[model samples]
Target: MRIGIAGWFGSDNLGDEILLHTLVSCVRSVDESASFVVFSPNPDRVAALHRVDAERMPTLRARGAVGRQGTAQRAIRDCDILFLGPGTVFQERSPNLPWPGTLPLFARIVGMARLARTPVAPVGVGVREGGTPAGRRLLRVIGAASVAIGVRDQRSGSYFGARAQVIGDVAYALPIPDTQPAAAVEEAAGSARPTFALSMRPLAPDTEAGLLLSIGGCLDRLQADGWTGDFLPMAFGQDAQGEDDRDIYRRAFGNVLGLAGNPLNDREGTTLAGALDGWLTALAGYRLVIGTRLHAAVMAVALGVPTVAIAYERKVHDAFVDLGLGRFVVGPDVDAETLHRTATAAAGSPAEFREAAGRVARQGRIAREFVTATLKGLG
Candidate 1:
């Protein structure tokens, strides 16, 4: 079986790359005869970063911004099945460069599949409010896909009718490294001072300069509450590509906190793998997580740490809601007191929070089944 995956496959970001890794692995596990074709913007970059050989595997150039129209059409014509939105395909964007706006390409591919009578399925994608008429229409077109499936919470589910299936985030099924993470966790947990895991992406449309000030005030409030704030960089591809998370954070918090002994300095330029290790390590030690990165908060939950999700978009809220962690998410514009209050609430019942995380982890089992069954059904 030949399956074509259309999403953020070859990005340097660990979180986005892991979606492809997990999905491809899951497909192979279910059917050894299955093969995959990944359409990546930077196939060479993906090859170097993830050590994935693009030529050996079924690959075609279908990068959104770089214009891979011919290759994408050809691949769609050849593949037996098409998968869209495994990663944050619905949310990934840059100022003046909204590559994801090429979402219509997926719809067009699905349309081509329909013309050819090939099956299509969308897995683990999110839905959010759109800003423009074209964006909304494009969303409806994607949502109305005949064989599309999604994993957003019930709130996001409202965007699509019967066609969209509501499951859990596929990130939950992300393969744990064979090497045990317990030692790293234990070491960080043994830290003498109160530590925090602060994962922020580059300054995006949702995150402004004021975010740092708000966070700085939050740090002072935490200190008053008997905690020390240590910023952890969950710098994935955005930061790896030289996007500044702390500079944005500094714009908000630098004046308030004085920038003395900031921990982010140690983690500024690390690769995604290194950052992942650091995230796990800090989770073992931090009193709580206060950050904007959705996947970072998910990592904290996976590690059984108390995490306060700061929702810059609806997907973040949906993630927290899916994990039954509605109380853990705060608005982007939340005040310092609100941040402290929510963090305190999340940390109040650590055991219960851990229990909820375990429950969230169990959702991964369902996700695996969902993909396996969907692929088998298509085949």
Candidate 2:
């Protein structure tokens, strides 16, 4: 069997790479003989790293009419089925980015797959809240094209209604090493002050001042409590400079530790690029984690780190709920005093948090099963 996957992969975003890697690993667990042909933005990098045949994802302008042929058409023809999985699939807006949206791009993907007579199954997809009228219609077309659909959370299901099964994040199901590096764990415990991991992304201009002030204030309170933090960037843009999250996080904390990286995009640490297990292992070493990115929370929970999710988007909120860490989530507008209290409460509740995270990680097995079942039907 051959599976063709298309997503925002190889874009210098570790979170998306983690999602892609986990999905590929899970599929192979069910069918060792299966091969993959991926459609990626950076096809050469993906092909080399993933050991798969890859082609550039279709350009957004190519309309998939009855007789036209292109890269997407040829790849779709070769695969038994096409999958739109992982990452924030249906987001219509970005905080500061200038791109229009994904609706039209996905419409073309499903359209090309439809023309090629290959089934398009959307599994482990995230649906962002709020959509334009035309975005809504394009989504219906994509849903109608799918053989089966699995959404990342209950809130994501609202967009697709009954057709979208609530599949937990497949990335959460990604396995981590059994133990963290002793040095990492020792640093967290052996240091004079406890240290937490912190992650954030770009916010709208209106929200930045208030959010930064509160975040700064919260870190100040943690300082009083003898705690320190590190800023970890989940994404490093392909443009050589780091992503906005790196900058935002820099402004949020005065004395936070941050690793310097080159154009290599290994924002976490050296030897961490494209390695989910390694990243999770480093995350496990932290006494606590507070992050605005959904996967930052996802990765943290999977490692059973005490976490506070600052929900910059609804998907982050929904994911924490799915992880059984609902109470740890806060909106971006959260006040410093409340955030300080929440952080202390989380730090105090490690055992309970670990228990909840383990339960949810166990449940993540269903994601593997769902994909296996989807493939079984296709076979």
Task: Candidate 1: give the clashing pairs.
Answer: 212-252, 212-253, 213-252, 213-253
Q: Which residue runs of candidate 1 sit more than 4 Å off their true CA positions?
A: 51-67, 91-100, 115-117, 131-145, 176-190, 204-207, 224-229, 236-285
CA RMSD of each candidate after superposition = 5.3, 3.6
Per-candidate TM-scores read 0.77, 0.89
User: Residue-wise lDDT of candidate 2 within 1-379, one digit each (tens)?
Assistant: 8899988876666777778888888888988888998887677667666678888767754455333337668879889888897767777866533344776777788888888899988878887666777776777778877898888887666666578887788886787778663336766567766778778776776787788888888988998898867787777655324355667755655356654232235333333235555556667777788888777877877777788999988888877776667888998999999998998898888886778778667767888888888888986
Question: What TM-score quantifies how close candidate 1 is to the native fold?
Answer: 0.77
Those runs of model 2 whose alpha carbons end farther than 4 Å from true positions after fitting are 61-69, 96-100, 180-184, 187-189, 239-242, 249-255, 260-274
lDDT of 1 by residue, 1-379 (tens): 8877766654445456656666776777888877666666556544544433342112234234234555556666677787775755554253534545545555566676676666777777765445455655666666676565765465555545666667677777765432333335446557445556566666554555456556667777777766655555443343235445555445454443322222223333433333444445545555577768777788667766788988887778878876778988987778777887888888775786677668766877777888888877774
Best candidate per lDDT, number?
Answer: 2
Candidate 1 steric clashes: 4
TM-score of 2: 0.89
Clashing pairs in 2: none
